[model samples]
Target: MAQNSYRRPAALLAYEVSWEDLDGAETEVSPPKLVEQVDVPATDQLELMNALWDAVTFDAPWVPETSEPLRLVGHEGAKSTHYELVLVGPSVAGGSSPIMTDPRFAGEHDAWDDIALDKSVDLFLDQILVPLVEVYGLGNMAQLDAARLSKMRERVRLIYDKHLMGLGVYLKAGPTGYVQGMKFVLQEMVENSAYRLDMANMIRDALGESAQNKVSIDALEARLTARASATAILAVVQAVLVGTDVGKVMYDLSASWPEVAWSAVSAPALFALSPSEGVVTRDESSVKFTVLPKGATSGNYRYRWTTTGDYGLLSDLLLPDAKVLDTREREVWYFHNSPANIQDTDRDNVSVEVFEVPEGATSIPAGAKPIARMAALVRGDTRVIDPRLEVNSGATPADMYDSGETYPCVEMLLRFPRDPKAYGYVVSIVGMGGVGDPRNPNYHFRTGNGNVDYRMDNKIGVNVSDYRGTCAWYNGFFGGDPADWPATEPDEIMGSGGYDASNETMLLMLFSAVDYDDDEDLGAEADLWKEWARGATFEVFPLYPEDAR
Candidate 1:
């Protein structure tokens, strides 16, 4: 079963590895990460190279940070609030998660609360509290025992709550404000949630996970969210934040605690999507695509637009089949009520023989004088129509009206299939959590997937959404209500300073199933022009309701 890719390389080529760490230096320098690469003579044998790779990998050592005692660099509280709990010890991924370094600014679209709370709790438990407890001998005491840990967790809960209430500040700021300053770092941590367990192990090792020591969670709670152990850690975080000597603080807190036993915390299983036991085949439209149910737990799973008036957008619908669903925006058609030359004079009749509009969609009138014409957004003086432009066999472009100015077309149709949902046109997916009673009319929603909301807004001036939150604008299928659009022509908020959720814009091309020759199987194909696709299997996650987390 081993293929050519698995075969040993024939050459003796050198290999390099890298990492990024914030070291206290005048400036970042060579081998900049806390860890340095291991050097070995080149070898033609794969096994030998892999062995060297393993040795230098997971168990490798790292350089210590250049600075000690992270400080409140900005956001001064009359004087420097040197953070108490310093969890900087062993590097899991080249550096320890630190509370006392640097300041951050949230991105225009970043949900700072979402970023900070999740990270703070995770780090508080795995990186900070767990280690202190293990070193002090205050846990449930048995790595293999579960019931005892559960009982001790009650006291731990009270401990965390009491301190959180007493300190009234988190990391020198109110819990919310303090974390806003760490937005960038916090976002990185959220992106690497898989690092949570690794961080726990790092904490365990830092506390001496040797023949004499073992560590486990006290109450795992539901995986990642509201961990009782983590919550408990919050109560004692103040000790770490303020302690001039962490070892002494650990010793003192354990001595004050009356618990007679030590217990390990349980690990919680993460809630993740899985593949369903079903088959997927292509849908027959002019294009080819396949859809199968990605299994979801029997709970809330619904992903929709977070911003009002912002439905997803697709750029093109002309291809008979598409190997990849193209979100890059391109104009399918543009016509002027008072016509002017949009093209450099080759054809004068706009083609519309293949334009598909939904039966009830208002973008295009139900009945109008049909044109044997099509249009494309073209460049330069070229009369050549790029075949990506969906034009019928006899279709051609229309000439400019004698007025020499192209007036607006009152009706513009985005090529949408009859049933968008049936064909699965929704783009991004986000897991949501609900607040308050679900039966109440005023119930609210929260994003709780612990993953960054996958958005289509990346590239500028393209068919897909631009979500970098940079306030850049493009002329694609604008998802806002037509009534809300300015009375003037398409412009970037010409009369309006801005709109809400300035972070995103999307254009989705919905291609319905085209009939195929194969009755037992469905298939479609489209020339995703430019050969930009790398043949990666595209996956869209199912969204969950806010109440379901």
Candidate 2:
């Protein structure tokens, strides 16, 4: 058959044969066999291939084809004949089957291998199986309605709020406060064993009447009996009373008591047994009570002390809880001395000194001389005076008295006071010489025409007169002319010398008294005779540590 033909021929057969008897009897013959030609359409051939492919694809444990021949048989007129059928075309021995090679059925033979079985199973579970199980299987066992679930959760919350929250509040009220309220209940319990019902009713009244049906009184009683005991209650009371004032507890307890016979009479009687003030160091303490009404004395009373005091004895009463020892040394000494003459006869004239007074001593150690003295002129004058002198002298003169001057100041590298308690110090120009009139002393005292200024560490500048008569310790100072000083109070200079606790030493510079005069009365010759005296003082302040406060 042509491979591309739309129709193919198939043979149908019927067979007949005449048999002769061995004894030469009459032989019987069948009717003539018939043959029919059938045209198997191409679609039928493809359908047959597809059927075979589906069997191989769907069946588990598929068997590979073997070379055994296959036959079809039919019986006719008591005789049976078999016809062998053979599949002919391109052999599928070492390559793909003819169905797979065909253009119409290409890739159809192995298409089953490309199927994603996992995805199909997942789709079944996600879309079909899961919803069916949830709707029917779980629905029969649980209420899955959103409204019913919400109501169930709300009921649980109501139970917690009505019962558990009230219990929490009652317990947090402390043994002293809540125990008094429960005293009547405990006394009732001791008198009668059937107290669980009463407790449930009491809880319902305290929490809400709606909870009467929800609370299981039997369960609550079982839990309470398992956890609570008289000995434990007494231990709690004893623990709270230790290091506590017993008299205060009695007074507080009395204030909450009713005006019944037990409270009015028995409570006061019990109070008489406890000492008005006493210490309780142990869990148990013996107390003596005298019954004057009955003319009897008893020593069986138990008392617990409850004050939060450092000293627990009657003799140590009224003492502070803790003593604050302010051991900081606040003793401050002011060391002042006058340097008789400070002058600049030559250029760059400067005098340096080391002024130190021992603690508790009034004066500097004897024979302590200036550390350095040189003929180096150093002076600071007002800007107005400095320019005028430069113009008149036809030469620019250095303003050595300014704190920034390095050459000609009386530089004192003073150490912080050795006292560990010392935190800060105050430097003051206590007194000055060459003030012609005490009543009208020139606030800006001058040698010739140069003004004197003091500086700390070549940074903080202040006029000597700012500290003249006042003992105020300021952490900052204003420089420049007095007219340029701030009308309002100047802002404080942070890290200035006054309260600086970090710096171990500070450089104090006192500028030289130099000749810068241009006035006729103050001659150039007056620079030789110009002299001044300054008396400065150092005072240290004490700092108390935080613990001492």
Candidate 3:
């Protein structure tokens, strides 16, 4: 099958606050802030002209319409007008980063024609551009020499074309979609380097030497910085919306798993070993589904190869051999060898059923260890299903030390080799169910009015001390006493109520830890679960990091 390519946005609308009427007076807007009646090529204008000339050929639609208006009017019949102006482009919605955020294109016009592709492209462009300009605003032009300035303009042009134009397509497509857009942006940067430099210098000169009260260069710097940060945030948000390639990689790997190589047999009858459910079968291949019963609440379950393959697939892409067994009843059992090409004597119709295995009998092979272990108990797999990071409202808990606003949590998954003697994987559950204090219930710990009294100073308690040259922050002795802590192990460090490892997953979440009252924190728990599911997908194989090997 041909790989899915990036989709473009249909309409890119740039909004320029043309003019605003405050009370009864009119005001003008300036560069980076223009105030005037904004204009598009105009649908009616374009259509009437096109129809007259039979020039309309493409399905390109006009940009979206807005009630906000090109010019803002004061209440009733205000004699004066104040305006903020903007320019938007059709491709801005789905175009590359620079085009998306290009100051020149104000996306205010409505679409004359409806093209679904155009809409997507518009959305893509809109999602990305607004932020880029906000964040990287034509940085310091004073330092640019003539040649370098020229180069910078070229760079800007390249950014406009590639990153901006390619907005509609997926970012993961890499150089394919946005690469060209990036090039365009660089071209724009090169073409307009001198202009942008002159503009910046003029603004600096004007603002820097302004009277004590006028907008100062310092103020502009602050404002520009804020804008840049906002732009960066928007870019990050759009990248996330475009979706990551990680899940796709997981699904593809799962489809090629070894289980498909083995003939599909009737679901085996599970025997109770140590009062645990255990089902056995004579089949093996790339991917294997061992449905361990998650107790009685979940009915006769099926842990088959998942179409999405979000979890419960072998880690190593390589094939493995052996009989298939179901562990529905949480029992353990030894693998029973089958005669080569043997058929069962019983003539009864074979049906797939829950395989429960007693825990003791199904001990993992001590001598022949697989690099990783994968499992998904239907009900027990609650961790796998609910609270997918993609759909969740809560991104991350709000940092309490700062304003009560929340930080977006980044999701990551990692797979590690299964250990026979020790628990190989550890998941840190934050917010709500795990770490949050229920009494206060602060999602990001923003105490409102009367809620102030219920607040706690800090969530986690820690003792800071120095050992030799290293500063050791101790939380607790989980699994053992504090004295038994593995001081030399760099991976293990103080976390939440105890020490935690620096495994790929752990490190990802740990770095995201922020201060918020448990009650205020919203997304950490979901983040933890989603991270685990992602980690599970990776664990489907015995794949190891390069350093580990």
Each candidate's clash count: 62, 14, 146
* Highest TM-score scorer: 3
lDDT of each: 0.23, 0.25, 0.27
User: Can you tell me which runs of candidate 3 are displaced by over 4 Å?
Assistant: 1-299, 305-525, 528-549
Query: Candidate 1 on 309-368: residue-level lDDT in tens?
Result: 111111145532222222211122211222233222111111122222444333434453
Query: Candidate 3, residue 200: CA error in Å?
Result: 8.5
User: For residue 448, what is the lDDT in candidate 1?
Assistant: 30
lDDT of 2 by residue, 107-226 (tens): 322322222122222222212221221211112111122222223334434443443233222322333433442333333333434443443333333222333354465665554454
Worst 10 residues of 2 by lDDT: 259-268
Estimated TM-score for each candidate: 0.17, 0.16, 0.20
Residue 518 displacement in candidate 2 (angstroms): 53
Which is the winner by lDDT between candidate 1 and candidate 3?
A: 3
* Candidate 2 wrongly placed segments (more than 4 Å): 1-177, 181-227, 238-491, 498-549
- lDDT score at residue 228, model 2, on the 0-100 scale: 49
Candidate 3 global Cα RMSD: 25.3
In angstroms, the error of model 3 at 49 is: 41
RMSD of 1: 27.2
